[model samples]
Target: MVKQERAARTRQALIQAAAEVFAEEGFVTASLSTISKRAGVSNGALHFHFANKGMLADAVEAEAAKAVRLITEAARAWQGESLQAVVDATHELTRSLTHDTVVRGGFELAGDTTRRGEPSLRTQWRHWVEDSLRRADRNGALAEGVSWSDSARVIVAATVGFEVLGGDDTSWLSRQNVTRFWEVILPRLAGRQDLDRLVSSGSRPSAVVPSAERTSG
Candidate 1:
């Protein structure tokens, strides 16, 4: 039991170290020896857990995918038939990317051409947003004549833009910046009657209803 626990800790440490390295140096340039050194684990141990840099990258993508799912699940659990859940999820993601190196690296690696075969967090997120907005439209949360595709494009572009910009300047991820984004877009997306129900601050109540449904794009 002790050995298993120790192995688990070591594996987690390696994943984290790899994420840090991948975030700083693109996937093509990062080296396994550097990751092992950062992880404070022997190169042999890293090979035991992950056969190569690609496998380590796969692990990082999986961890990052888990983080996106948490934000998605939390937002989906919100009580309402509105796009508020989507807005809240974007806020949560923006905050995560700003504070969590794993999440940031996952996104960075997702864009790297060399990591093509691994799961794409960017694709998954886009699908989730598209699916959620389609549901919202069917549920009457969207404004009359406002198409879900256009709304999806706007939201995805802005949120993704923020994520990219934040990499160079963290100010892009600030609460005020994200809140202002919601404020500008919500009016165009939500019906007049539903406008009052939406919050530009992207705040959600603490309650979440777990659902087993999952989506893959």
Candidate 2:
């Protein structure tokens, strides 16, 4: 039992180390040696735990799932609140997921055609977003004429769009961009207008999540 516990800890350490590196350096440029070094493990130890870089990437994604759960759990805490509060909470949950390292990384993974069909981490994510929005719909948060599924689709897709476009050679995605996108989309889903007045454009925020959340597989 102790050996197993230690092994699991080692595996997690390697994954966390790799996640930080891969998020910062991009998959193509990231290296096992660096991951091992960051993890404070010998290269052989990382290889023993993951077998290969691709498997390590998959583990990194698993970490992203935990991050999604963090936001999902937070939103779920609003159990029986008012429709507006619930809607706002649920909207905040989606924003949390998008703003997270693992969830954002999952979007980049979903967009990668090569990685798209490979167990698609976004499958869980898509379900989470769609279901949460559906809950809001049940609470009458959406516009009277709007379809929850459609609104959910639009919100998820737009978040992905921001992740794709807002990154550059110097940075990953911007939190301000993601947050602004959230503020804009939430009003629309609720059938309210005034996106232009939410905040002035061209305002950028500091990085919050890991870059892997914004980069592709």
For every model shown, what is its TM-score relative to the native structure?
Answer: 0.91, 0.67
Q: Mind sharing the TM-score for model 2?
A: 0.67
Q: 126-202, model 1: which lDDT tens digit per residue?
A: 89899989999999889999999999988888888998889899999987898899888899999888889888877
Task: Mark the regions of model 1 whose C-alpha exceeds 4 Å error after superposition.
Answer: 205-217
Which numbered prediction scores highest in lDDT against the true structure? 1
User: Per-model C-alpha lDDT, please?
Assistant: 0.84, 0.58
Clashes of 1: 0
State the TM-score for model 1.
0.91
Q: Model 2, range 187-215, lDDT digits (tens) per residue?
A: 66664432333332222132223335423
Q: Native-vs-model 1 lDDT?
A: 0.84
